[model samples]
Target: MTQEEEKKKQRTRNLVVGGILFALVILFYLITVVKMTGTGA
Candidate 1:
């Protein structure tokens, strides 16, 4: 692939990975909060 194409692919990969990580963090944070508060009864 050309240099430009390679750069674009790398950028896309980074964005996807970053998005997944952000989602995971948010999910974990929510889980922690729920655990701390406890379920109803």
Candidate 2:
């Protein structure tokens, strides 16, 4: 593949990975909040 095409592919892959990581972080944060607050002490 051409250099420009290769770079575009790499950028797209990076964005996908970053988005997945961001979603996981948000999911974990929400889970932690629920675990802490859902049940009263």
Candidate 3:
């Protein structure tokens, strides 16, 4: 593929990975908050 196409693909991959990482972080934070609250949220 061309250099520009390769860069675009890399950017897309990075965005997807970043999104998943953010989601995991949010899930972890929520789990911790629920545990602290003791409501089993």
Top candidate, metric TM-score: 1
TM-score-based ranking, best first? 1, 3, 2
Residues 1-41, candidate 3: write the lDDT tens digits: 99999999999999999999999999999999999999994
RMSD of 3: 1.2
What lDDT score is found at residue 20 in candidate 3? 100
lDDT digits (tens) for residues 1-41 of candidate 2:
99999999999999999999999999999888988897634
TM-score of every model versus the real structure: 0.91, 0.89, 0.89
Tell me which of candidates 1 and 3 scores higher on lDDT: 3
Off by over 4 Å in 2: 39-41
- Mark the regions of model 3 whose C-alpha exceeds 4 Å error after superposition: none
lDDT per residue for candidate 1 within 1-41, as digits (tens), equals 89999999999999999999999999999888888899624
Report lDDT per candidate.
0.93, 0.93, 0.97
Clashing pairs in 3: none
Return the lDDT, model 3, position 12.
100
- What is candidate 2's CA lDDT for residue 26? 100
> Which residue pairs clash within candidate 2?
none
